[model samples]
Target: EELNMDLFSNCMDTVERCLRDAKMDKSSVHDIVLVGGSTRILKVQQLLKDLFNGKELCKSINPDEAVAYGAA
Candidate 1:
């Protein structure tokens, strides 16, 4: 329970920082595309949904294969 909370908190903090650094508001972000293994975590998905104000997330791409696709 504690570990999940910590992960969610950290992910929230990181996303907030990224938005700040980019001078972008959460409202300005229309789409959220998640990649990589860590994004498979349920907490992370929930965190993203909450952060983006329940905007639909794109999960069409296979998370595990994302890195390979990027390289290709």
Candidate 2:
């Protein structure tokens, strides 16, 4: 739980920074696509759900294959 909390803080900070840098509001985001295995954590998913006001996350791409799919 402690680790998840820390990770959640970092994730929140990063997301906020990205949105701020892009001059976009969280409401302007249509989808929240999570990449990487770490995102499989339930706490991480919950944090994102809460952050996006219960927006459903896009999980069409396999987390393990997302990097390679993007590179391709």
Candidate 3:
């Protein structure tokens, strides 16, 4: 749990920075498309849910294949 908390903090920072750079608010985000293996972590998923106020994450694309899919 401690490790998860640390990761969550970092994720929060990154999200905040990205939102600020985009000049958008959390409410403006429609979907959270998680990519990469770390995103599959349950703790990460829970943290994101909390961050987004219970918004359902878009998991239609396989996390592992997201990069390849994007390149194609």
Candidate 4:
């Protein structure tokens, strides 16, 4: 539980920082695209859903394949 909490906290921090850097508010974010394997964690997903006020997260692309897809 501790580890999950830490990961969730880190994820929230990163997302918050990104939003701030983009000079946007959470309400302005239309979608949440989670890449990389870490996004598979339930804790991470729950945190994001809560942060986005229950907005559905976009996970259409396989997390493991994201890097290759982006590079192509």
Q: Which structure among the candidates has the greatest TM-score? A: 3
Candidate 3 regions exceeding 4 Å error are none
lDDT of candidates 1 onward, in order: 0.87, 0.88, 0.89, 0.87
Residue range with the least summed lDDT across 10 consecutive positions in model 1: 1-10
Q: What TM-score quantifies how close candidate 2 is to the native fold?
A: 0.86
**Of 3 and 4, the candidate ranking higher by lDDT:** 3
Segments in model 2 whose C-alpha atoms lie over 4 Å from true places: none
**Model 1: per-residue lDDT, tens digit, 1-72?**
565798689878999999999999999997787887889888789889988999988898898887788789
Question: Tens-digit lDDT track for model 4 on 1-72?
Answer: 685687679879999999999999999998787788888988888899999999999899888888888899
- The number of clashing residue pairs in each candidate reads 0, 0, 0, 0
What TM-score, to 2 decimals, does candidate 3 have? Answer: 0.87
User: After superposition on all CA atoms, how large is the RMSD of candidate 1?
Assistant: 1.6
Better of 1 and 3 by TM-score: 3
Ranking by lDDT: 3, 2, 4, 1
**How accurate locally is residue 6 in candidate 3, as Cα lDDT from 0 to 100?**
78
Give TM per candidate.
0.83, 0.86, 0.87, 0.84
lDDT computed for candidate 4 = 0.87
* Local accuracy of candidate 2 as per-residue lDDT tens digits, 1-72: 885687689988898899999999999999888899988888888888898899999889888998898899
